[model samples]
Target: MGRGRGGEREREERKRREEEEREEEEEERREKEERREKEERREREKRERERRGGETGGEEEKRKREREKRRRDRRRGGEEEEREREEERRRDRRRDRRKREEEERQEERRKREREYKRRGERGEREEEREK
Candidate 1:
């Protein structure tokens, strides 16, 4: 209704708009910082992967050679891998058999010791009876 009242309302609206603008600017600054941090992380990860790949080149070449050798063997219908596997199994079985034999021998020795102790106890009792 009055010029002074209208002026006062205008000043309040301007202040509210200025506060909203400040908040929007702050939000934009935060978003920019987040984007920069994400980009840095991605770059670091990419560099790390490149370094690892370079380090693994020798291992990759070794694996490639092994694969090629296996392919060649397959083409020739060679049983080299199977023969090696069987040999390993045979060695394992021989080792297991030896272990079992050793255990049995130790068990027999323990049995003999127990039997001798029993005989000695009985002989002592018989002597006491004779006394």
Candidate 2:
């Protein structure tokens, strides 16, 4: 029983040491990840600066202004196109309304003609019967 106790104590000590080692390894991994992230951030910033002409100067300012102008022009062009489309739609609607009204008038005239012909036929039949 004494030997068993000693064995149990040794196993517990070993487990503790293993846990500490794992924690240290995890801390090291976190440190490395942080370092890598910082390096990557610096690189991205440097690239951005280079893309923006490496300095905030008159040239960069000019480019920014030109970009803004182009954006505004595009927006204006889009608005003009939308207005033209709306006008076309309005014209189409007016034309369609006129066409429908014309069709309705023609239909009414046809109905009146048909009614008149029917009455004339009935009158002729009555006259023949009287004769």
lDDT score for residue 76 of model 2: 64
Stretch of 10 with least lDDT, candidate 2: 19-28
Supply the TM-score for candidate 2: 0.48
Off by more than 4 A, model 1: 1-72, 75-78
Off by over 4 Å in 2: 1-66
| Candidate number with greatest TM-score | 2
- Please report, in order, the local distance difference test score of every candidate based on alpha carbons: 0.71, 0.73
Candidate 1 lDDT score relative to the true structure: 0.71
Model 1, 1-131: lDDT tens per residue?
66797578659856865765686576568657866976896698578667766775687766875796588568535445654665576567557656865875797699789989999999999999999
Alpha-carbon RMSD, each predicted model: 37.4, 35.6
